[model samples]
Target: MTKRQQLEMDRGQDGSDSVHPLHNVSSDRSLTVYPRGDGQLVVETETLGHLTPRRTHGTDEGRTDAKLPDRPSVHGLSPDLLVPQPATLEPLDQHIRSHTGYPDIIYQATLIPPANFAMVAPFVYRSSFPLKKNFPFLLKLGIKSILTLILEDYPVQNVKFLRENGIRLFQFGVPGNKEPFVDIPQDMIAAALATLLDRRNHPILIHCNKGKHRTGCLVGCLRRLQHWSLTAIFEEYRTFSAPKSRHMDQQFIELFNMAHVGPLIDTNHLPPWPTLL
Candidate 1:
């Protein structure tokens, strides 16, 4: 091909172009292509009905991942049960442990609700006392073990830390910034549960700072997953956190109803929802 032809192909202006990074790109936008020789790249636009989005989305906007290096124990307490802050909700930490910090508790409440599929909880939120310590006690006291979590850029360190100390974690990453949000693949959560040796344990805990928005969304997902009624969820979470984390409860309820279907997510202990409409 001539140099001019090659340039046109690279610009995605020629009909004959095969591997332009942004296929059918607009003139004002250009995409740099680094192929398998570097890193394969492509871009494309989709129509939303008759309206064009006329907007850009992030490439790795709200990505959450595994692992972190263990940090020094905060407060005067040992690295046992801690309440990382930005949490305005009731102090479950005083009941569970003695230490606390604000921005330090990344995704602290990620245990699943009596199911194994929500292991991301411990990983996303690192703490000293494992949720395992609280589960049996909660159950003996007649509270259903339920935890809801939401976090961002959650570390794998939390996951490894919780596991080393005999705790199960559950985290679902929804990528975005601020109130305007987009979802990353939380389906990997179900995959995490499938790998666990046991699936029917209880006294699960889930958290996000303040145990409000993200925690709420997760409880909603779990309620739908286990076929529990919204009323049951509100009550269960209230029982665990005591004074009741109602904002979390309601937020989760909104998210659950958003799906408009009953496909169960906690497939480890609960059978899959029948996909009912």
Candidate 2:
């Protein structure tokens, strides 16, 4: 016989076998097997009646029945009771009065401003990186294309994201940096301008690593195409790129002649300049 059948025979040994071995156990109690199987042991619990104290009538006439408090229901409990409240901004502002070195601006991830950002025309914006994190902001601006001037390899993830979002990329890879003063190539400038002037590529972004030099040069050339005075163009460039802004960049913009690029459109007849201008 199996071990279970032997256990049953052992339990029925009394011959007055109408009653089970555990039949005398109370209704509100139970037997539970822990660490189940070969080495398992049974645990008996006395619940409700055995756990609660029974009052004797004579001595406990005026006494209240002592019982455990009911557990609070999670479904109806207020969230405030379970979690500590977050600090308020009003307190930070108040603390700023006494705290000398406290920061006035809080930096947030994915919320940093795009480097040297500016709008050159209704459909043309200029900046650095044009990161995937800033893609949502670009989408909000209705930008349809990107004109990248970085000499390095473009990020594959950014390329994939742009393709998925239906944004086109127009790259003009220019080597070297601002310190050594590499000149912006005429061919690259001509190609970028051609892309910019094309209505289908409207709402485009032009960017270099810092958007201060190469991008400034391209936008300055666009200003020349619009017949903007040299002073006005330089002033706009200076506004976007300050302190470390290069004089070579200004010279490049001043010498750029739009007549050589191709036929020019009248500024008044072309779409309005970017609102950010």
Regions more than 4 Å wrong, model 1: 1-163, 175-198, 224-252, 255-268, 271-277
Residue 80 in model 1: shift from native, Å? 38
- Which 10-residue window in model 1 sums to the lowest lDDT? 60-69
Model 2, span 161-200: residue lDDT tens: 7888898998899653355646777767877777787767
Q: Candidate 2, which segments miss by more than 4 Å at Cα?
A: 1-113, 176-181, 263-277
Question: Which digits, one per residue and each the tens of the lDDT, describe model 1 over residues 152-180?
Answer: 54456645545555654445544322333
Indicate which candidate wins on TM-score: 2
lDDT of each: 0.39, 0.65
